[model samples]
Target: MVGTQHAARILVASNRGPVSYALGDDGELTSRRGGGGLVSGLSAIGPDAEAVWVCAALSDGDREAVRRGVGEDGVRMIAVERPVFEAAYNGIANSVLWFVHHLLYQTPLEPVFDEDFRGQWASYQAYNAAFADALAQEADRGAAVVVQDYHLSLVPAMLRERRPDLRIGHFTHTPWAPPDYFRLLPDDVAEEVLGGILGADRAGFLTRRWADAFAACCQTLLGATVTTTPAGPEVTWRGRTTRLGVHGLGADGDFLRERAHRPDVAERITALRAETGAGRKLIVRVDRTELSKNIVRGLLAYRQLLTDRPEWRERVVHVAFAYPSRQDLPLYRDYTAEVARLAAAINEEYGTPGWDPVLLKVDDDFARSLAAYRLADVALVNPIRDGMNLVAKEVPVVSDHGVALVLSREAGAHAELGDDAISVNPYDIRATAAALHTALTLPDADRAARTKRLADASTALPPSRWFLEQLRELQG
Candidate 1:
């Protein structure tokens, strides 16, 4: 039974928390916390609704912090065992769901329902159960619970089974694998995944397309009642309604503008300017070194662009910050090494003593990345696939000289930013290279006009409104 407590306690759970920690030389864990859509969205969860973030801890320091509870009010961090996080993050979330969406795996070469896979599935289940148990403990009676991403899909159902009064919402930040692709999972697995999410009062995607895909899964696999309406659609199982909504995420321009003015940012920009010398059109990209990011392909395109068009040789520089991710996995390690190799090759092939064509930084430094955005004349956001590339939205809002964006059609942000961007197919090296060339050479007036449009599109659904819209619709 839904009750008035929906306005009170709210819990946000995901693989990554708003903060991360590291053990210092003094044997004390130091924590770094900051902003993003999730941070801002949960911030708007309001005074009445307490926000407790239960996230998996991957590092020794993270475990220490989790044990010590090093966080601000309303932010509760829980660190699962290292093995659980490894299998859950690498084996299940990235291996299974990521491949399902990007269609990255060759089905013929894929292993299905094998012993190794089943073991990983167990880890995945246990990890999600951890979040569900935490939510059930923290959420007061009738509290509203919002679970984030495919990683924690099972939590909605498990939590609801424990706390029926709780109003739960689940949002998938990746494309829903089509029913055909999803069928690759064992039949029981498929049914359970859909049913788990359906336990929520509301389920959300970034677009109508993703929502429709999810509805199709329910109708075909679960034998559920699926209804289409003007607002969107609904998935019903056992007389309970699970409304599907689209809350397109956005950038906090006002906050970013203020952050950009800090003295450290000014010094970094000055340093970058001095380092780059004169008349270099900067093409910037910031991405985690995940397989789906297609960093190797992006590098191929950059090289092809230089080889095919000699004129752009010394005119441009690509500032790539591929922050390290999932070093626990062999696949991730191999991918990172490949990226480093390509960066070195590109620099060697196209460099003088004074300049390198590609400036690749593996370390995750936000201020430096933001500084890149401010200096960039062309921001290359060619994600092989993304739920929503916040960089697409953030660049336009923070860019000092109104940077032109060369975007990939597969990105979730493409639906919103395509009209204003120089869109490209991430798979096609020549095409992406040409698109980059076009973006780099775009005129000032055109860049400004496109930047204005992109900024407007970026601001369409601010975090507060996005959060509120989901809350209001959940009640209906």
Candidate 2:
């Protein structure tokens, strides 16, 4: 910023940036932080890096707030502005792409990709175009521009056509469904999505399975030459060779340690423990209300446990923090309502005056989540499918008391943490319930050993190192 070359200027285009500008209770504009792998990884880049993240502003107030924030160190925080943002993110990103990647589409008899879908597709394009314009404006020649997730899939091509001199990279943090499932998208949308990504100088996915699926799509659909390996893919497009690599993301152990001991978090943990009563063992889960979370099944599993092993009912609690995600999407709203109904049913059947069966929270509070992590005796993470579920790794490393994990085989973390968990199929409520019972009843020595193993694996890579690894590939 002070007359130095800042490495050509790093530009990041995503659906939402790390910080959100909203009105605080005191009538002052306040900036709230973002959780998840992105915030940690981007923060690692620090202020000196030539980075400017451009994301959509969800409201008129948010756009005004972002316009003010855009002054920080040449940080061009551009918001694409309303209605389109909601339709693209909640509608196409979550309802369409997310469902496709997780295989969550309701395929009773046939798949639907009709005119309404095409209208939503147009909104998706407009949203991507907004980010593309921002990047092209901020990025210099040879600058590295990294676009994230399914929300901005079209940005790579939109920007590349305008600024071919810049280096672009795309990383998908979710599964890339098999070609058969993926082909359900209309021909025009399918071609544009693939071509947009192929516009990058490099691309990344979590596992080899997802990476291979991407390469196959390019081969079959785009007729591109692709060479694949265990962790990377090579694709040739328009006579330029773009690279692909996999870097398994890890939890920030130090940050967790620091936050876990924060004064506010300690207070929250005390209240939660006291409110739940003295002898209850806590099983904690923090997730957005996504279809792939399998929240309803998890609730059923808990019910099965209370019914099958009634003795544990009086002593165990599932403290679930499920935030509202993609609420504008009817399917997600329906899923949230369904989860609420299930929670109510279980409480009606099992609650006592002193104890509610499930302590459910439907809001976002990162500090409270960390507090729950510290208080957990058992952590439940059972995603039906995931690119990588970091909760399985993070909870073990951050918990103040050592904790056993009940994990699903479908989670990408299963490959690393399976040895330390009581593994179960996410679909099988009976088996998951049995596993939960077993975890709570695990002997102290066995629990301690498994907890130690899980903790060790959880912090294997820090966020700074994760981002550096990806850039190392790009630089080389």
Best by lDDT: 1
Over 175-252, each residue of candidate 1 has an lDDT whose tens digit, in order, gives: 777788777888888888899999898999987667888899898888898998787798998888898998788877
lDDT of 2 by residue, 1-476 (tens): 11123333676777766666777667577667676666566677776776777666765556777656532444456566466777787768887888888888778943577777777888899988877877877776788887898988899889889888888888888988888878877777888988888888888887767878888887877788897656456988667676777767788888888988889998888888887888799989999998898888999999999999999877988898899987867777999999999988888999999888898999898889999988888999999998888888889888776888999998878878888899999999999999999989899888888888898887787766777667656656
**Candidate 2 root-mean-square deviation in Å:** 2.9
Could you tell me how far off, in angstroms, the CA of residue 396 lies in candidate 2 after the best superposition?
Answer: 0.3
Against the true structure, what is each candidate's TM-score?
A: 0.92, 0.91
Q: Root-mean-square deviation of each candidate, in angstroms?
A: 3.2, 2.9
What is the Å distance of residue 383 in model 2 from its true position?
1.1
**Which ranges in model 2 have alpha carbons more than 4 Å from their true place?**
1-8, 23-43, 66-70, 109-111, 229-231
Clashes of 1: 0
Q: Residue 264, candidate 1: how far off, in angstroms? A: 1.9
Q: What is the C-alpha local distance difference test score of each model?
A: 0.82, 0.81
Provide the lDDT at 321 for model 2.
Answer: 88
Which parts of model 1 are misplaced by more than 4 Å?
A: 1-8, 19-32, 65-73, 79-81
